[model samples]
Target chain A: MKYTIFPGCLISYRFPEYEKSAKLILQKLEVEFIPVDSFSCCGSQVLESIDDEKMVLLNARNLAIAQELDIGSIITLCGSCTHILKKSLIKLHDNKILKRINKKLRLIGLKFFPKKKIEIIHIAEFLNKKEIFQKFQNLVVKKLEINIAVQNPCMVLRPSSISNLELKDRKIIRNLLTSTGITASSYRYMNRCCGGTMLAFDDSIAKDLGKLRYKELQKSGANILAVGCPNCQLMYSIYQNMLVDDVVPSIFFTQLLGLSIGFSQKDMEIDKNINTEIISNILNNSIKNNG
Target chain B: MNECKECGACTNACPLNEYDENYIVYKIFFGPEKDFKLWTRCCSCFLCEENCPYGLNPREEIFKIRRNSDRSNIPPRIIKYYENIKRTGFVFNIDEYVNEERIEYGLVKLNLDRIKSEVNKLFNI
Candidate 1:
């Protein structure tokens, strides 16, 4: 159970906690990770609108690196990165226009052999298996009893072969949470976008859209908003307080899971989180309740 | 000819109304002039298209808005990114950010001269 890890740019800098917690949890589950040292940024939203050719070439280059290392599965922490890489891989494998672009790679001393079946699994997908969930259950030093509202960013579960199996994805996460004695619920707008696409291009619209979703989650009375993607986490955390006048805040699923497993708040870098005191209180209550 | 149902279902189903209420679907078929700006705000999620009873594709109307928006008024940031992509066949600052770690990890470092020759031969660029 080894995978080539693609942390993307946001995870490496803005949200290193996700990278740290993910590595620790996966290792605990006996999943070996080989980080591709020379990996480039997986040109996410920008590539699709800008250069479809270079997007294919760059992504294929990453996949080639994994193939070179004989690692068939690639795991990503960003939903946007997962979506972009998965889409590009599918296109490279299925589209003729992309074949011509691969020929260009040959000139750069890179062979574009697309036969590799590189499965780009999200961290959630990697942790969704029953074996991993059972291992996670065994390792839980504290069981969080608080209600968490799960936010599934659209890019993560859409536009790929996995979209057809989205129902299974929802169940997997719920089952994992339930095994740990935590209560998780699917909120309305659970399968919506987090406005990542419009963030850079139209900041106001992006914020409004994010605020709209946050308001809905707040109305549901969930103590915390559990997120899988770093981009979505950042967006929600940035606007969480502003969106809800007086309500609980959001936290990454990794942060919550790490806390439940007896990882210190400092070790998980929880203090650096942008969300409010309500989340901190929730984490404190989880520790006390489980104790 | 079907009478005006006035059900407002098309207007009610629009996601754009969250941002702009004046963007009515009937505008496309009945208004004096198309308000192209209303269409630009659409995310193409297709909620309106699904809800329309007359089989009107609001998503297509958005495409028309994207195509008809004044070229001079195009956002400079988007235009610049698009142009850079056209020139290099990549959108990101790949050449500027290529580091030793990336090279050692097996990323194919692009040879500018070789890539230029290949693009020229392939697409007659």
Candidate 2:
């Protein structure tokens, strides 16, 4: 199946490895990705504070561009983008205030018909498809054999619309890890937020929340925290170092998957990771313990 | 509305009261002056809204509080950041911190000038 890719801001600029590995994994499964041209930010965190009309217009414009390309579904790498776009789409379809905003969008020559259905799936969800998972299973040349805690931040779970699918996401990750002969330990608060909402407004609170999760995962005896979204990864990484006394490390789930598939840590760009040394130790320990 | 009994069950159950004993949900429901400061701490987890004796969404009430409060009371930096976003369409100066090492990993750099122009045109700023 083909999907129009929306890299969002963070993945496009800050965490490109996510986009790279995402594209690689999707291609390995033969899923076609059509990049949407002339796309703008999905107004993730900004929309919550700014005027609702502006958020609707910006997201609708992107959706309009997707419609222009005749691609109905847009896959996103960032959970924030997915939540924002999905919420905006729902509002555009259900609220008249948003309808007027779409009309205003037409003044800019960007006509947005809210009736068009645009499916926004997180990259993790797209990869979780049985066929894709099977292909991913076949590609694993080396076993990860590591115990990792999965952190699903609030942006991924809030708004309920997008996160409702995440229950299955937890299962998908478990299944993929087991298939690769990895020991994936499920821990409590797996679905808790990383306190990212307060990152900008209150860094101390965000740090405290991050430290809380770090301690929880540390107690779980997981060496690394595997995540799907970059924002979550960034927050966890920050907490692991600046807040939690550098006790545990955080890595993107795709990075771990890429490594287990015999992709070099450098090839996966894992070497550039701030927590690379700790992660390396974990991988080494997992391998040594398994043998 | 039958789902909500107006028993103020959610108000009593709220954790916000622990932070500020006077920060009760009934005060929000009855008082004319809405103190959003009490509600801003809400995680938006919808636990109170979901558990409401009445189907009333307490989260919506918190949102109303946020809307009614003086925008100036918001952290100046966050306010400025939002203004920049609304005016420029891009998160302002986002490219300056785009770690160069990230570019080598096949990460796409956003055309901030293009995003700024688009947002400016849309907002007529």
Candidate 3:
């Protein structure tokens, strides 16, 4: 399948490491991915709330880029990006909406042919595909000793109509973690929101949710947290550090899998994550033992 | 006129409801607006739909309400984010330091100049 990177805004601004490691892992897995430039934001929930037509316009531009380049799917790192882009992909399938959006796209010299199909897939779900996982499994060179509580991006699975996930499919992230031979602990409220999106409008309530989630994660005895979305990354890594005294550090699943695939800590950009100095020490010790 | 058992499974499963007992948003969402008790709180996690026994989607119903509600109900901060998107085609400002960071991380620099004008045209409508 020909796939391209969506490069949603959050990853570019807050967490380039996710993009870096994801590219590196995809390279190692022998999956060919194209890098498309001049792509705009997915017009995430914030955009949908304000103007549905404009939201579809921006995403339609990006989708049209894929169609023009003959790319089959656009892989994304953020859950919100996956949701927004896929929502538009489905919306553009309607003949009336496609005509309306195309009127604007023509000005930019772009067009979206809904008949020529394209898909939006999140990185976690992408890696869990059986063939990709088999290739990824062969790359494992380290099983760093640690207990991790995985937070599946809620948007990637819910509102089932858009995400189109079945019960087995929702288990993608957790299953990918366990495959690496690390300890996967079950945390209460693991399936809930990280309150990152809510952090935009309601900081007080966001902290309330974060405090509750961290308590469940800490109580579960997990030493670290792995997430698929940057919203969750920024929340758990940055806000959790500031808001809570006891913190179970967070990393992208790409980073965790990068470690098992024999990429170094620096390769994963672990230092960018605050409150992860303890995690750094664990990796250092694991490396020394292996050495 | 609505099909709700008021099973409270969604409310019980809603983490937001854990802190605020009166925020039975699922109940409000499943019923008519006249039947709604002035709803509050939606983090948009959609667990309410996930937990519903009869496969009803209370979350979408709640979003339908928000999308059509008065502009006054939307927080000013959310409006600011909306403004940012219209201005730059991005949620946050991606300035020089950000581009430098992308280079250091070995990713391509974004050239939104063309895309921004295109977005401006779309927004002008």
True contacts kept of each: 0.04, 0.17, 0.61
- Give the least accurate 10-residue stretch of model 1 chain A, judged by summed lDDT: A159-168
DockQ of each: 0.13, 0.35, 0.64
Off by over 4 Å in 1: A160-164, A242-244, B1-74, B79-125
The per-candidate count of clashes, in order, stands at 2, 6, 0
TM-score of chain A of 1: 0.90
Clashing residue pairs for model 2: B3-B54, B3-B55, B4-B53, B4-B54, B4-B55, B5-B54
* Candidate 3 Cα misplacement greater than 4 A, ranges: A289-291, B32-40
Tens digit of lDDT per residue, candidate 2, span A141-251? 887767777776445555444466544455544555567776766666566556565566666656666666676787887767777777777787755677767466777
Candidate lDDT scores, in order, read 0.63, 0.66, 0.82
Docking quality of model 2: it rates as acceptable
Point to the candidate with the largest lDDT: 3
In the predicted model 3, the residue pairs found to clash are: none
| TM-score ranking of the models | 3, 2, 1
Question: Candidates 1 and 2: which is better by DockQ?
Answer: 2
Residue A118 deviation, candidate 3, in Å?
1.0
Q: Pick the candidate with the highest TM-score.
A: 3
**Which tens-of-lDDT digit does each residue in A1-291 have in candidate 3?**
787778888888888999999988987887777877678788777877667778888999889988998999788999889988988888898999999999989988999998897888998888987888898888898887777898888899887878878877877887887888877899876678787887776777878888888888889898889899998987798889888888999989899899999898889999888756888986777678766
Q: What is the interface RMSD of each candidate, in Å?
A: 6.3, 3.1, 1.6
Better candidate by lDDT, 1 or 3: 3
